[model samples]
Target: MPYTGPQSVDRALEMLDAVADAGGPVSAKALARRLECSLSTAYHLLAPLTERGYLVRTAQGYALGPRIPGLQRSLMQHLEPVPRMADVLAGLRRATGAEAYYTAYRGGLITVVDTTAPVTDTGNPFTPGRETRAHATAHGKALLAELPRPVLRRYLAEHGMPRLTRATITCAEVLEAELSRVRGQGFAVSVGEVDPAYTCLAVALPRGREGGRGRDGGAVHALSVSLPTGEFRRRPQEIRAALAQAAAGCG
Candidate 1:
């Protein structure tokens, strides 16, 4: 069989593990010697990893960064607050009579990690692992709005804003302008873009107190509510307020 594992990912983890084993910062020279890689290669990997918050550069050397704990928290399936998060989502659903979704935006993709949708709403299309329509979803827009300028520019360049509806922002300039509004308003709105009848309101939560934002300045997670067009129009401000309030609790 072909060697299928991600080599870079494996190396990065190994570097992190090696540092953890030392119980303190590990210099690049030591890392290169331990990993049996060239000094240049070790430094190369260290630079990007540090930039992305996977590792931090210290006076002694490189050490694991604060963001690692948040990533670990996300992966720990048996963690305690999962039940609380479920309760929060359930409450959001009940309050708006709409589906509540918890989403994470990372690695240039949006992943819907969880949701609380009413059984009666079979037409609900979003689910975990659905491809992100960054130009058309409130969660996507909210997260995208937080991306650093360089990262955001690269993202739009790679994934040109394909229109899903007449309301979708297609031009880079327009999208930037809209993202500015999202940042200013502290939320994002998507109306009939992903689906003709559905509207979504979302708020981006702070990544972690220690890590602040990701290296790219984007939010690590977003919470959103999707509802029918008529209902959204009826109480858009009310829904936005509820989402912002819930997001505060999360932060």
Candidate 2:
């Protein structure tokens, strides 16, 4: 069966994602398969967007159009300021002596909002951006563990747990159990789940005051530190104490 809610709009968005994922203009047939729709449906979905300049059709196929730049600019203008999370990220870095990060969960995406000033000083593994595998990182798990049960379930349904390493929790049931433990412990830990040589610990930060208006506008954020696996294991107590103190001041 085809999508029922705002059928054309949903189909168009799916088509857009398919084209973008293809990394170039894609044939209507390939897009149909990617969208799990018929060739005719794919054309029908793309036609209006193409005409309206949301998409561009070339001899090869369709790509994002010029209008996208304007739209992106408009989006940036409406985004919340970045300053709100800067001070907190700086404080976390000083307290932990490790790469400190502030990540926000919103619209079913985990985005790194701010990182400490010296992100590369101690050889951090990750850069600030949207994370690919939420189930394999301490900060991702911390944010996931804080979500209400229903929302958590919805997120899992939309984005299944994908394995990133031998230690990643690929099963939903197991992940739920792990999140339960995270809740009880008041923090989340990832040991070689994201990187074979790294360990990370994270604690969920409360939404900001003033209705959570910074870095993606009310997106829930977490504080985290990454370390070499050996160092993390050796100084677990000390690192946890620093993380706890930093997390306490997030709001």
Candidate 3:
């Protein structure tokens, strides 16, 4: 929780950062190399966080714990951009009668900064501070598409695509093909990939006024709209249009 001045803790933080930058789960060995620490030392550093639930060990490997995203969201809630994004999402909800979410990508993972759900809808299952799936989500695909080709290719190679739902992209080849389409189209959409009943559409975040350090370092944000199945099927193009308009508003 609180960071006392311990070298081990510092190393642990470095390891966590490595995993986050990886954009997917990372192995202890990979994290150790990234942190430049011994394997034992890396596991030691990861232990406390895993126990506390800031990291999760899944069949795929180590992913960021759900709590970590929540913490980041809380910290970002104070920023001006997030509030503005919240306002945008609120308007999107009103306009489309659906759930809207704003996501920001800095190092590796794309995290939700805020969200708004229509009063009538049940709301998106994920929210501010939740970790959005990179493969199964429109925002995830959009973010990956935003990355430079070489960088994105390496990432996909290291983290093989896994099936989330029956609709989830199961092969790297297919996913990359779809990412190529997203790159050309300048946005990404999901049809029951994340959840059988949910549809999501996301657009690349408008590039902020220059001067920022990052990987792609171009787009710092993304706009996503998630809604129930039937409505999305009925008005797919309309929802995509709204998402694009919302992103276009960013200065």
Candidate 4:
């Protein structure tokens, strides 16, 4: 089904996506090419976005504007976890000596809402935004495992499973089998799927009256811990135990 809504609004949103995807300043000509529209039409779409502070015109080209951070802050406010969830994540990080993350599936996307500050300079890969590689992420898999088959199919159709690493499951059938295993085992694991250097283990938090519901009436929240692949493999039981404890605390 094609979008039957207003064309201008759809194109404006697409233009913003193009700018974000560029990862740097992008020119109107490049955006026009990406959006499959004329340069003039691109400018028309850019004008409102610029005026609205969603994009900024830089000497190099158009870049994400300051307003983007404000939107993120507002979103975080709404998506903030229960007060104790942060303490729970912090305790999990200390207990397992790994980065702890609290993720939620909302608006058809998985987002890391809260996380313990990186213990090392390596920094955290799971940030607070739309997580693209659901097929290769433990928190993503935990949430995806709870979705109904039809909703899962729609998600895969919209966001094709891209091979981020050699370990990433590119085949949908294989991923479905993996998700089935996650459902049976009550947890999800990502071993070098997103990055060969790291591994993640995650468990879904039980759904409650306060914890939001998903399309399949399953818990939308998940807790995950990430560590170096070697350390993760060496102490898999310890990591899983910490993750389960954190999930229970959050629930």
Candidate of highest lDDT: 4
1-251 in candidate 4: lDDT tens per residue? 22235888899899998898776999999998998888888998899899999999999999999899998878665554455887888899899999888887755777877788553444566765578888999999998887878878888888899998999999888999999999999999999999989899998776531333357333377889888999988989988987887777665
Clashes of each: 0, 0, 0, 0
Which portions of model 2 miss their true places by more than 4 Å? 1-84, 117-123, 208-218
Give the Cα error of residue 39 in candidate 2, in Å.
25
Residue 111 error for model 3, in Å?
0.8
Candidate 2, run of 10 with poorest lDDT = 208-217
lDDT scores in order: 0.77, 0.76, 0.73, 0.82
TM-score of each predicted structure versus truth: 0.64, 0.63, 0.64, 0.72
lDDT score, candidate 4: 0.82
lDDT of 2 at 225: 88
As a whole number from 0 to 100, the lDDT of residue 156 in candidate 3 is 64
Quick one: ranking by lDDT, best first?
4, 1, 2, 3
Q: Model 4 Cα displacement at 158 (Å)?
A: 1.1
Angstrom error of the Cα, residue 207, model 1: value is 2.7
Number of the candidate with higher lDDT, 2 or 3? 2
- Give a tens-digit lDDT track for model 2, residues 1-251: 44456977778887877775566788888888888888887888888888888889889988888887796556333333334556766776776677788776775677776677354454566666667667889998998887767777777888878777899889888888999999899999999997889898998877542343223234666889888899888889988999898777654
